[model samples]
Target chain A: MDKVTNEMLMAFVDGELDPAMRKEVEAALRTDPDLRARAAVFEATRQPIASVFDPILNQPLSLPQEGLRDGTEQNRSAVYSPGNPHSRTPGIISWFSGLFQPPKTLSVTVAFCAVFLGGLGLGFLLKAGLVTIDTPEAGLVAFRDDGLVAAGSLDHTLEKYKSGSSFVKTVSDGRELAVKPILTFRDHEGRICREYEITYPATSRYAGLACRTEDGDWNVLIQSPIKSRPTNGKDTVVASGRDADTVDAVVERIIKGDALGSDQEALLMNKGWRGQD
Target chain B: MTEDIRERVIAFIPRLRRFAFSLTGDWDRMEELVQDTCERALTRHEQWKPGTSLESWMCRIAQNIWKDGLKSKKHRAQVSDDSLHFLTGVDGPREIEGRLTLKAVMAAISLLPPDQRIVIALVCIDERTYAETAEILDIPIGTVMSRLARARQALYAGLYDSDTSSACAKAEG
Candidate 1:
């Protein structure tokens, strides 16, 4: 038999040959020591990997036990099974089927990251007059620099900057043209945290922030009024009459970083007006 | 036919896992990938289109599931190769079944492009004919030949580095 090409030899090794061709290759292999050796090494790999996986066929799958079987499931068997109430994944997440929750970001961390990046950036940017930030009575997210990090392969989480003692309130015009504020959060690093919804009044909208004032009123830590995108008269970023709290282009900003640890966060919430006062 | 297929596939689970383990050096992940594939196929059975070989079709889905699950953030990173890969320090050395050489070969196989990998896994590991592999992949037979050729060369080179010394050296020499 003439010398076979590498492709032919590979095909032969894989048994993709007719009986005549197989006989020819077998004949050649008897004379070719190197070819035989090459075949042996290639063929040997199948056995080891097969041996490695053999137990899996017999082993019943435990969602939690074999969950780490996939690197993508770093959290282990918790896809459908919540470990506990405090550890439950966010309800909004359930809406997105087939969407990989970033193995890295928790819902609260996601909430803060969303609020901080959007709140701070919009808060500070609108203050500087680069963009107009406004909000209805409901707080809006104000992120100028929502520093978001990829939590895992899929989830992009953001880090918020808030402290238990200080929720920076940027006052605009004597009337406080910004929207209302809500609770605050302090990250593990002791930075402040905030959240907001898209709020609108008349022609304008605000991504509100969760800062407060010395007075009992939840202050507008920061707010940005969106210059509404032109639509087909019927299209809307803000529904004409209803409250629309969807995230805008800054969806990436909204979920990042380690969310505030529980103890300090509760302290700020419980002390709310007292802390600012 | 579908009922029979369901029965046969359930029976083939052990066999399929063997094929999967061959592709991936680790057992745990291999099983996970296969289960994901089967689950996906069962739910999306309408797409299976009876009469075609279920094994080839399922094999395609298994590879896709494997591809979906197989991602190494470190491989694409621009970090200097001089430093240990972020995972290297964490996972220790690669998990080889017995010899480091065999493990190295499996990693090489994993690195095959999805196109070639599809063909190789279907044609080689599953022992399907070229026509069967082509049908499963929805490509032409000539494409199968070319990809298989490329896949073979890549495995050959990956299995043995010309200047290096390892378990593969026995085959290289």
Candidate 2:
């Protein structure tokens, strides 16, 4: 007779055996104290693991946004409709929706403007510290008439540079916006999106992700605080959300597949994003 | 037809939430992962075969998202210290000595590698069969059995090992 291995014992504990094998194990256990004891241990081990975490089952999870739990396909489809900004196309929105998606309490700003930076004047103004963004708590950290200016510049730089490359260009205001490309990939929607770090002299530094919207302008997805540290005489940009795990988390959520290589990126840049078409 | 599938996916949310909590050990991240999994499952629900294991399918989606969102190879090693702290709080401080609090069990589960942890969550916690776990994890049945056995053995040692719990108790104290 084959000695009952731990695996077989576990199978018995889990009721995983057919009647013939189960009878065999039962017969073996009837005479073998050691095997029965071992089976008891395996069964005992499963109790805490299975039921210990059961409390969470009763602890009510705040339901997913209104549309998710309503049991209607229209509402469900709205959660990821192509036209919805919160599309889970590459499935990123679902991952960081808690952090990036604004709560119902705060009024969402949905201003769509078609403005392009044609010359260095906008860059100069952007460098001269004129842009201001409204903050609910801090009154106003920095306000820009158009949030798209800084986002657009970062987008342009990403188009021109490869991932892991950084360049500093002095604006007409004598200030520089250091643009560094960190990640570039197609989103769930098959649109090319890039994450970059931007440093504004005498202003603020930010890490942002911008996806190439159907229109020419990039849709600024989410911007989070970045902590800058001087490393080897160069500034190292560190994310400041969720213990600095935000960027990589966001990347993992939205990435459709492996990031685009240089050639693929160039091809994407030339053709532009069209929602997986 | 799509609405019917979405409705079924919604029914699985509570269990999915529990499974996500087991995997992430954080309330906020668990909710988000479940939400993401639901959205993805619905969006790609067309690919899912009808009359098959829907809950198992959703579990697979959640696991994939969790695996992808991990930051590094080390990130996949085990639950982090922060997560351990969070796990400890789940049962609160009212646990009597030697009674086997959920926190202690979670701590032990957290010590397993992420792969093993998922198997434990699906098989042991969610009560998925070995075949079903293999489907959710996309591993072979043999691999699921092997992993579960190792996970069970590790949990047994972690929970019953006097030295390990005493040390943990000291650290908590």
Candidate 3:
């Protein structure tokens, strides 16, 4: 047989060689120290390289909420149910809605139809400029000059929903948006801040952290468009690149201690966030 | 059909993330690459033909996006430093030792030329066969073998030959 090259050794190590070639290499390895050492390099580097990135697979998949956009209520419900273990937990969404009925202190009812119509009305008003948006970005039209006030269904959800609860709002244009509060933590200034993710169906996603002010309004402290694809549908967005980093940096900066537990969040909600201050 | 494709793309995310990490060897860059890959795969999904390997197709998109970004950016020098921090941040002696070794492997992998690096990521890390890797990267089987061999040699030298630590000494012995 001709001299076994490094390429051939590598192929042999990878189990790509036929049985005849494999036996030839095995025979050479048994006799030739130099050839064995060369093959050893290929063998040594294989498993570590394969296993080094295994940790990433176990980490949470940070996907944009793309596939959940175009579905019906039943489809959306099924996507989050326990049967679909891959989907993010639906417990968080249903728990808050179940635990706290519409805020009795507030005038608005908790009915889905009423909230939908209210959100539709507010969406039209925002579009008509009757309500000014201090920062008008896609998936973030709810902000007002007084701070980042949640309008319509978002307003109701923010006022009543606990951390991890998610609700969908359909606007006048028939676009369905999913809003979910991800974390609840107190900031260094003793204000209760909630980090949230808003997904604009077929368009973009926005992540923001808003603090509840003394007046009981959730003021947007920071909001960034974390992901946006090109309208042409060809070019790709960097997904959760710098924008997500910026939001994370802000969260790391102002956040005090850990995020509130589900029980802690529930207690704070029951208190109407009053006596804690 | 688009909905099915989208679900399949979502399912392929964990593998794509692993492939992305192998390519970039930095957490932040790996994330960016994965996201970019997902967006491209989801948006231009029609370009992906059925009956082919979706995992390989997505990986191809990730490599292209990473290469395009590389063209505009400077070569990374901070990956090793970040890996060091990651290594030390963990607790438990056994876990720490494992992570330290893994981080060293990753740092070494990061230093390979991008071509060799991608080949390693696909063939070695992702466990794709030579022919499959050739198909994914659109390279000949001969090219894949050569790159894989050279990359493995470089990685072995970087991990063992460059140091006289007990681990290296044990491996060599």
Candidate 4:
């Protein structure tokens, strides 16, 4: 046998080789370390490549309208403008937004309360310009100057809160927001970063990540809206949407080790994030 | 017949999306490509014969869209190489490490040349056979085999081999 080539190994890995050639490659693989190692490359790369895009399958299909007759250029832009929610097809947006609507069977007082809360939430969302594509940093109202600095209530919350702890802070508008720290970990740079979720009662929810800088200031790296599906009486965290996936990808990129345990987080918090890298 | 084509096109959305994601390497662009592919497939339904593989025809439209520069060059260039820096990082537990490895693999695939990338997408990701991929891309089976081999080797080198310095050095040697 004239030594097996990499292409032959790939064909064998893909099961594209004929049985006779496959038998030869298998025999070689059993006896040859270098060939075995080369064969491992195809086997290893195949699994992740096949499964990497599996998440896209479960997402709602965002196809164009059934009878759209316009030019491809015109319809493509109108269907998906990335950050712009309004430009999205109304049917898809309505399907997602409908999940947030209040049920209609509540008492008059409860309905009034729901209306009031919904209005306040809408006001906050509008004031923050979160609905528009122009404001990519819509949820991080506490951070200024390109999210390098965390100030106001968010700064205080990040400094003191432990994982799984929740705090409510009333903004100047008298609307209270619930903030909870989801987890803590040291990033590759050895800086302590926290993943937290903020909920506007029944209105909206966002997940954010921030890391402490050298000067003790928390820098907001990314914040994204999360969808919470109401199951039974409790709200369960469902899909985190595309922006949330970006946050997770960034976390995967920077995280150094396992998320800090509660005891470790407490020790770090007590020492003001000092004496550790 | 037109209704049948429309139904088949809709059914192939997930497969098309996976292929588009591999080629575009970005979610937003993937959606755009899928939409455009769907649009083109329906509008030109006459070109598609009744009994052939509709998925292959749709994939061809997608490849042409991507190759004809419907996707901006600048956006393709923006698939960042940042994941490459973390390839040699210390591993965490199995689940976390598995996820990080997958992310790095995706980033590496994004960097492959368009020809090899599509070959990998069609064969590896979309699970297309050599003959089927050759027919869809209008390339020879030998070319597909070579490209798949090279692409997988590049990915393995870029990802797994980075963690084992001796293996990497030996592979280079």
Best candidate per TM-score, number? Answer: 4
State what share of the real interface contacts each candidate retains: 0.14, 0.36, 0.40, 0.38
Reference-based TM-score of each model = 0.38, 0.48, 0.49, 0.49
lDDT of 3 by residue, A201-235 (tens): 53567887788888877887777778654645675
Identify the runs in model 4 with alpha carbons over 4 angstroms from their true place.
Answer: A62-277, B70-77, B80-102, B163-173
Residue A87 in candidate 2, Cα distance off native in Å: 24
Off by over 4 Å in 1: A30-277, B1-36, B65-105, B123-131, B160-173
| Tens-digit lDDT track of model 4 for B1-173 | 35466546655765687688778765556666777787788778899887889889999999989877634564452343332122212233223222323345555666666777788888888889999999999988888888878777776666655454443343333
TM-score of chain B of 4: 0.79
Model 4: per-residue lDDT, tens digit, A1-277? Answer: 5889988988887788999998888777755667766776776676545644443443343323311222244553455322223333332222222222344422332333233223343343344442211112333345455555555345655776677766453222223455667889999888999988776643577778899987888888887787655556665555435344667788888999899999788667655565465
TM-score of 1: 0.38
Q: Candidate 1 lDDT, tens digit per residue, B1-173?
A: 25565444554554566466555544445545566666766667788777777777788787666665556422211122222121121222333212223244456665666566556555555556787878767788777876777665566555545432332232222
Cα lDDT computed for each candidate against the true fold: 0.43, 0.59, 0.61, 0.62
* Shift of residue A42 alpha carbon in model 2, Å: 1.5
Q: Can you give the DockQ of every candidate in the order shown?
A: 0.07, 0.14, 0.16, 0.19
Superposed model 3: Cα runs more than 4 Å off:
A62-277, B80-100, B163-173
Worst window of 10 by summed lDDT in candidate 1 chain A: A149-158
**TM-scores of chain A in all candidate models:** 0.23, 0.40, 0.45, 0.45
Stretches of candidate 2 off by over 4 Å are: A61-277, B71-98, B165-173
The alpha-carbon lDDT assigned to residue A55 of candidate 1 equals 29
